[model samples]
Target chain A: MATELIKTRKLAVGYGPRGKVLQGIDFTIERGDFLGVMGPNGSGKTTLLKTLLGLLKPLSGTIETHAGGGGRPLFGYVPQRESLDTHYPLTALEVALMGRFGRIGMLRGPKKADYQLAHACLKQTGMDARANKPYRALSGGQKQRVLIARALASEPEILLLDEPTNGMDVSSEKAIMELLSELQKEKQTTVVFVTHLLHTIERYAHRVALITSDGSLIVGEKSKMLAPDVMARAYKEK
Target chain B: MIELIQVPFMRHILLAGVFVAAGLAPLSVYVVLRRIVFVGAAVAEVASAAVALAVLFQLAPFPIALALTVTSFLALSRLADSQRLPLESLIGMLYAGGAAASVLLITKAPRGEANILNILFGNILTVPATLLWAMAGVFGALLVFQYVAAKELLISAYDPDMGRTLGIPVRAWNMIFYGAMGVAVAIAIRAVGALLTFTMLVAPGASALCLTGRLNRAFLVALALGVVSAVGGVMLSYQFDLPTGSTIVGLLVVLFAISYGIGQLRSAA
Candidate 1:
């Protein structure tokens, strides 16, 4: 088993009145481990993922991401495709290269090595040949793959995904999930994935954190968390 | 009529229009894309308020208006950056405040056809030499935005989140763009007047958007359309005995319609 790579203490998630969707949520994942967070909509599962990724701030408590050492954490992120305006003029390759922007800094453009790295990421994600394609022209599956390649370009020590399989047809979803799984198995990068797909939560997640309405995190093993009674309570349907 | 270019006033009118179109057209694209329409109008109202003050105090209207535009931008910059309100809401508030100030200025000024009518509706035919210089200054500001701030501007215009995620400094970019746009408007408002400023700001850019498929292409087409509209509008206005700014705007509307039609057909095909 991989050693602990992330730690959070009593973190709350969400914004405005909806803020604190997930409350007092404490969690951790080891390097090379896959942890899934599952909850009903508005339960703050997605918000918690955003918090961990530094996309959103916790209302209370602290979450420190281990980028490994003093260096900024190099990690991949797969944002929901719908959140992006695919109609933007950038090509898939251009969009993917945006992953390097943090390191590329201002004034200076990306280097050849950066492009090579992006290409390699694309190759790994099976998107190399489609690099020239306009981002909008790509189908939903292709966009997800391109996004995954972009995340990988950062060569992050950890990968954070927000509903990666959503808005995708079953075949596309299956393909993308398989690709991610294959990547994790080979790369040994820590994976923190959020999803509502119960089958995925059951099948692929090594550990699971169940979030209740009002942003409460219930953490445990996947099988333990996936119990119907636990889910019923988490969803508050019982 | 052709020999009138030798006259300084007519020269100022046509030249100021050139400068206004140059800056306003592309700016409108950014405005439309950013979904912040009437930002130019708001800024112009503030400038007009400053002009009214200068007139009341017997100060030079252009210089005073320019100063007020800058002042509003500095204040608005702070307001725009603060998190209490969304940028759009803040700009709207600024708009209302500026209009109130200008209206107060006009109310307090010596009410005359020359003071209110000329300043409010714009004295395009009587535009003076100084307006040309103001146009040059604003055009320089626009160049800075196009080159010095292009990348940041593009990012901020399209996806502010991604811009922030990439650490492009969205706050600074916002301030700079808003400030530059304000400066550009202050320069042109005297020539185009408050009522018709959006015509110059929005028309050429909107027309170009209709004309082109890509961002760069859109901007280039916008520049060309702006120049043509400004020059053509004045001449056509004279030819048809119409208002100068209106004629220009009408021509721009026609171009936009034509381009839209063509783009639609092309898309259909």
Candidate 2:
């Protein structure tokens, strides 16, 4: 019985009033829960993630995020890799160091301790050797790993990733899944991974939230949710 | 080159050039990263318009120009944050409007046409000591601000979505960066001229980014390129009797091309 980290009750997320893209998103994530959110294109998976991260206002309902010892439940968000422009002159270490910016606060920069933590995070992701490499030079898998490392550097109680394995090769996808599994169990950190990969949701996720085209959400244990009938019901709506 | 430095006016002009370039170079990295290079042009136009109006009405120029420039920057930053229109479209509209207003304002001033040419194509050779000191102060302040706020600014510009998730106050950082750019552009237009200020705000950073894959090194390289371009351009212009501002701009373009070529070659290798 782990502590409840995030609990959403009838959550409605959208761009503005009257523009609700997702509603009735009732779910509870406990400490160390690896939850996978599965949905088709335009199924509001991203909207839900954004809402949970507090990046977007919840159109309706309530979201309760239990605070940790630091007085807030810090969240590390790994946005879709496609969303970032890699052509900019930044190194892997530089990207990882971004995690420390919040804790480092204003007027002061990343000091020695911050850099050490960033390096340690990179090591956790097995990206320490390539830390000096330009971000653009890394392979897609490597880039994702670096991004996850960035998220880890923040020492969040919960990590949220959007489409983390999209476009990755089978080996890369498996590697990412394994790394995420190890991270969750080792750190007791809750993870909300958003993707459309059915096999990954069935295999890696402890719990699954399936969103339908009609804004319906079904959440259950992975084994029950991935049962043929439930998946069909989740995807069949138009 | 050394002979030119012997002249007091030339010395003041060169120092002014260095200050303007150094102040604006580091900022240009964010300008390029955020894809707001055109916003620099629009802000310069607004500064120019303010300057022409101040001169025409016998009001103080720098204060008026700086005020209007900063206000316009804030407005543009807000518009950009809203995501209503594409940033390019907003910047383009502002550029055209500011350009037209600047032309109209300059035409109505006492000694109108001459003032227009001077504002559009400034005389760095005649930089006043007071103006040089002003540039030094502004440049120093910008350097110090960047030193303290570089990481936060970098995080905000690199991936604002990530910044927002971390509760990094992305909007506030955007405002601060734009505010600094406004001051830099306004101060630069006095010596670098309205037309050349955009180049100073973009070229050095672009060139340095082309040459380096690290942000810290890029900043250092940008500052060096800016100083070199200013010093080298002034000497070349003096030696060839070329227009100082345009000469410096041409030199920066050449440096950018060279850097691009080198960067491409390195990537290929």
Candidate number of the best lDDT: 2
> What is model 2's DockQ versus the real complex?
0.77
Q: What digit string (tens of lDDT, one per residue) describes model 1 on residues B56-156? A: 88888777877778777667666754446777876787789877877777777885225655655776676666667767776867865686555567766
lDDT of 1: 0.74
lDDT of 2 by residue, A135-217 (tens): 88899999999999999988888999999999999999999999999999888778999998888887899999999777868
True contacts kept of 1: 0.12
Which 10-residue window in model 1 chain B sums to the lowest lDDT?
Answer: B111-120
TM-score of 2: 0.95
TM-score of each model, paired residue for residue: 0.85, 0.95
TM-score of chain B of 2: 0.94
Error of 2 at B182 (Å): 0.1
